[model samples]
Target: MIEPTAEPAVEARGLTKRFGSKLAVGGLDLRIEKGTVFGFIGPNGAGKSTTIRMLMGLLPMNGGDATVMGIDVRQRPEAVRRCVGYVPEQHLIYRWMRVKEVLWFCRQLHEAWNESLARELCQQFELSGQTKVRHLSKGMLAKLALIIALAPEPELLILDEPMAGLDPIIREEFLETVLQSFCRGGRTIFFSTHMLGDIQRLADSVGIIHDGRLLVHGSVADLLSRTKRVRLALERDELPAELPQGVIRTWRNRRECVLTITDCDSQKVQHLEDAAQVRVVEVLDVGLEDIFKDYIKGQREAI
Candidate 1:
């Protein structure tokens, strides 16, 4: 288990936001420790972006509070911005300016901008300083946005779907760059995305949100360990009218039944077998993607 430290890099308590009668985010409580790569995942319009914007002080909350790098977002938003780097889904840079000019302009805005780091990143990304932003490809544009965020050298980096539209190769490169360059010296990352592969690869911890509510938050290993797929072969070619406890979802045909379950253990499995009156054929590990799908599906069914 990953132990949390006393002080968290980011913390939110009862964070709430609303658009007219629509509640975008509701009572979201979260904590991300320093140096941890935390993935915030949800489907589209699941309040992932709304929560992030509130945390970044770019959006006003209807209720509750948040702190980024130990600075209160409501009271000291500018201070929080200074201590955190943010990369929104859209790259809103000046397309008319050259890459070097863009860097220069942004440098003047930030007190702790690292020119050396920015130059190094430009070289690594093969971004020519003289090239205009409009001339850069989608991949290059994405790299530039990342470069701008990292060059600030903030304690916390908040990314809102940073890899949303990139091709497979560029996405791989982006993840690798983040892993190698930014995940050092105890810098924290709060990454928001619907990509299960990215979360599995990059995040130490994960939080899943659905309909403005956080469904689960924990270490990746712990979640995977506790969630499993149990295959059962029944003597009778029929399933029980009611599912066993802890089973989130189930699929069956004839004598075969596959169960998706949570909080799984030897005792739980034994109970399930006894309760369902079925013979256990195999207990299989569940992947992050399947787990995510099950969670979302379960929530949708409940609604």
Candidate 2:
């Protein structure tokens, strides 16, 4: 059975990493609850990979602590590795190893390896035992990597941009495998990706990172319920210095103003309308991608 607990699947406190003059990750503190599919979204070079590498113990943390499956990752990386499966953005396996030889080597490392599942996954991914790792296409290599990770039946799975370069069809195939196998087993999945649609389809929770910091983190449903895009048609051309409550950002042209706001509900919108003496033209629902873009737009535009 999947063995998550009250202690959380993953936790990091004040985790920091630096490269000489540059700070790659800056004091990130976050948690992933048991049995969750948590999506990590960030802009390019936002330190997503650095953070994941630190968590997996592949790289050292410049400061702070991280734990996976209740074990200190920095101190007990083997313990953490035993319980977690990782799919990186690119293939990292030895190219000279034959497909089955690689599988055999991986199988010997973990006590929990399941041969039946491995066999089944090979079939699902259309991989053959005779093919060398170098011969496998990118999509097939991804499948191979995923199968190796899953065969150990890890309680937590970490995927860092696992779909990065795959064409749409291959991406769909990989996503389907994750949904059917990992999600079905109650394993906690923490994956970082630029593909917001993947998060929309698979994540129970979402966290957005920008400039080495988490801008927002929460349950996807709750976040969606709390934020909105609003348009107001006002009698006055000039907006009041003190704008309506809940506004995050606002844009105005003549008699109309568009606002992005949080904690937005029917009551809040009604109150804004009544207080401002303006007509509420539209209250639009937005998906995760819109929210992600909105959060980063200001940070980028500032420069």
Candidate 3:
């Protein structure tokens, strides 16, 4: 059972990271509830990886504090590591170690290691004990990282670009495993990815970071319900080319006009239709990708 109002499994209060003259992450605050799939979306070099590293205590934060599983990550990095599992964007396992040896080594270090769970995971992922880590394909390597991280059953799992460099079939399998096995037991997942569709499908909440700052963070339903794409099928071509106020994006397709309206009520769409007097065919759902593009475009225009 999830503990509502429980202390966050992972908490960041005004976290900031800098590199000389550049600010990598600027005053970010985040709270990851227990037993949730929280997705982080941002382009490469947008500070997602930097933020993760800081949270993991691989890098020190310039300001603010981070706690993982109620332990201060900066002050007690090793203690936090004991309760947290991290899979980096790049594979970092020993290439010469066979799969069985690596698992055995992990079991030795992690106090919470469950041998039965490890063996079951190896079977589920189709990883052979005799296979050397160097001989495993990229997909297999990714799965192996996941297994190692999860065998100890850490309270918080941090995955950076976990789906990167994976084939389609492997990606699906990986996601299914995460949703079915990992989340089933009420573990919290902090996953970063550029795959908007997966985020939409898997995340209970999402945080969108852009250019070293957080743009928005909320539940998926709140974003979709708050942002909508208003599409109208015109009876004539006399409609105004200019979009209504609050419309972030507009597209015209010969007798039809599509407008992406932000933070508006459903009644607002009816008002727009009445003002235009156009036959409204349908109001299409706005996707996260389109919303992200429009947000970036608007930011560019503002500058």
Candidate 3: segments with Cα more than 4 A from true spot: 1-3, 230-261, 266-284
lDDT of 3 by residue, 267-299 (tens): 767676675548774677777898877766655
Give the TM-score (vs. native) of candidate 2.
Answer: 0.91
lDDT score at residue 82, model 3, on the 0-100 scale? 81
Q: Backbone collision count in every prediction?
A: 0, 0, 0
Residue pairs of candidate 3 with colliding backbone atoms: none
State the weakest 10-residue window (summed lDDT) of model 3.
Answer: 237-246
**How do all models score by TM-score?**
0.92, 0.91, 0.85
The whole-model C-alpha lDDT of candidate 2 against the native structure comes to 0.85
Query: Residue 242 lDDT in model 2?
Result: 54
Prediction 3 global C-alpha lDDT: 0.84
Predicted candidate 2 versus true structure: per-residue lDDT over 1-303, tens digit per residue = 324467998999999999998999999998998888999999999989999999999899999999888999989987887888999877799899999999999999998999999999999888999999998888899889999988998889999999888899989998998887765666889999989888988888898888898878888887787889888888788554455565656767889887777778777676667755475558988777777777787557555
Best-fitting candidate, scored by TM-score: 1
Off by over 4 Å in 2: 1-5, 234-237, 244-246, 274-281
lDDT of 3 at 262: 75
lDDT of each: 0.87, 0.85, 0.84
> Can you tell me which runs of candidate 1 are displaced by over 4 Å?
1-3, 233-245, 252-257, 276-281
Deviation from native of the Cα of residue 109 in model 2, angstroms = 2.2
